[model samples]
Target: MSAYAIARLRPFAEPGEDVFTYIERFQSTLDPFGGRFLVHGGQLDEVEGSWPGYAVVIVFPDRATAHAWYQSDAYQELVPLRTRTIEGEVIIVDGVAEDYDPAGMAVRMRAASAGAV
Candidate 1:
């Protein structure tokens, strides 16, 4: 299945030059893992809720590729810079397949909850 890197970040501290430095070299870390940005932080429409931060989404070929990119040494080295600048959450998530069925899962869940499965 495809995977994604989703992060919601906003400046919590006085951002320094290191944040720019991290951004400058961020792409290099993703190249080896075949990760591409689906969305990079920008001005939000905010039609629903009060969102004062940026939302970033990156797509990878698979969950393993996504995890590998996040865990790579090159990416690891840049972590401190962002940590010092932004405060937010980042997560890797698996994407559903094309033929995914919600009804099937509901049925299965109901069975499991009833101790039938």
Candidate 2:
């Protein structure tokens, strides 16, 4: 199983706080946990619905790994910084694949999501 953490963020009231700095620090903190940053803040050219100010996705080996990272002391400490800098949603999704086809499944998912299938 693969787990993903999806975060949608908004700017905080404090000008001193920012996600870039927090992510930089958090990246180090998460290094020992076997977590990988799949997506961080980048240019957003499309707006289909209510888009957050920032969005991120982190991938982990499993659900336990993702949950442990979130509850870990290191992350717990950094959470306040994230809280100060953003206001939005966070989600953890675990994908269970018995016979996964990375490329084929991804294409199908994209097509389905885009209403092209």
Candidate 3:
């Protein structure tokens, strides 16, 4: 199953040269790690709580690949640039398979725990 790395960014100030530089360099870093951008920038409609600023979502082949891309030196090098410009949260989550069942997770967890006991 595929995984995703999602970033919700709120910029503290207008983008500058360093921000532009990070954006340009960051694009190339994804391909090497089987990662691709799913959502870069688009109109956000907040149905609930207030959310300000931009959001980005990147898809990877799996959770491991997503973690690798994040921990890679190339991506880490650009972190400071982004941090200097914005405040945001990033998270990696597993994608559901085609046969996904919401209730099955609890059953599976119970079975695994019972086995461990």
Better of 1 and 3 by lDDT: 3
Clashing pairs in 3: none
Residue 43 displacement in candidate 2 (angstroms): 1.8
Q: Which stretches of candidate 3 lie over 4 Å from their true place?
A: 103-117
Please give, for residues 1-117, the per-residue lDDT of candidate 2 as tens digits: 889999987755664646566767887767877888888877666557767477789989898989999999988888887776567798999976878778997898988999963
How does each model score on lDDT? 0.90, 0.80, 0.91
- In candidate 2, which residue ranges exceed 4 Å CA deviation? 12-21, 96-117
Best by lDDT: 3
Q: Per-residue alpha-carbon lDDT of model 3 for 1-117, expressed as tens digits?
A: 899999999846678987899999998889898898899978998999988988899999999999999999999999998888788999999999999997999999999999999
- TM-score, every prediction: 0.85, 0.72, 0.85
Lowest summed lDDT window (length 10), candidate 1:
10-19
- Per residue, candidate 1 scores C-alpha lDDT tens digits across 1-117 of 899999989755566798899889999999999898989987789899787788999999999999989999999999998887788899999999999999999999998999963
Q: Which stretches of candidate 1 lie over 4 Å from their true place?
A: 11-14, 47-50
What value of lDDT does candidate 1 attain over all alpha carbons? 0.90
Query: Candidate 2: RMSD over Cα atoms?
Result: 6.2
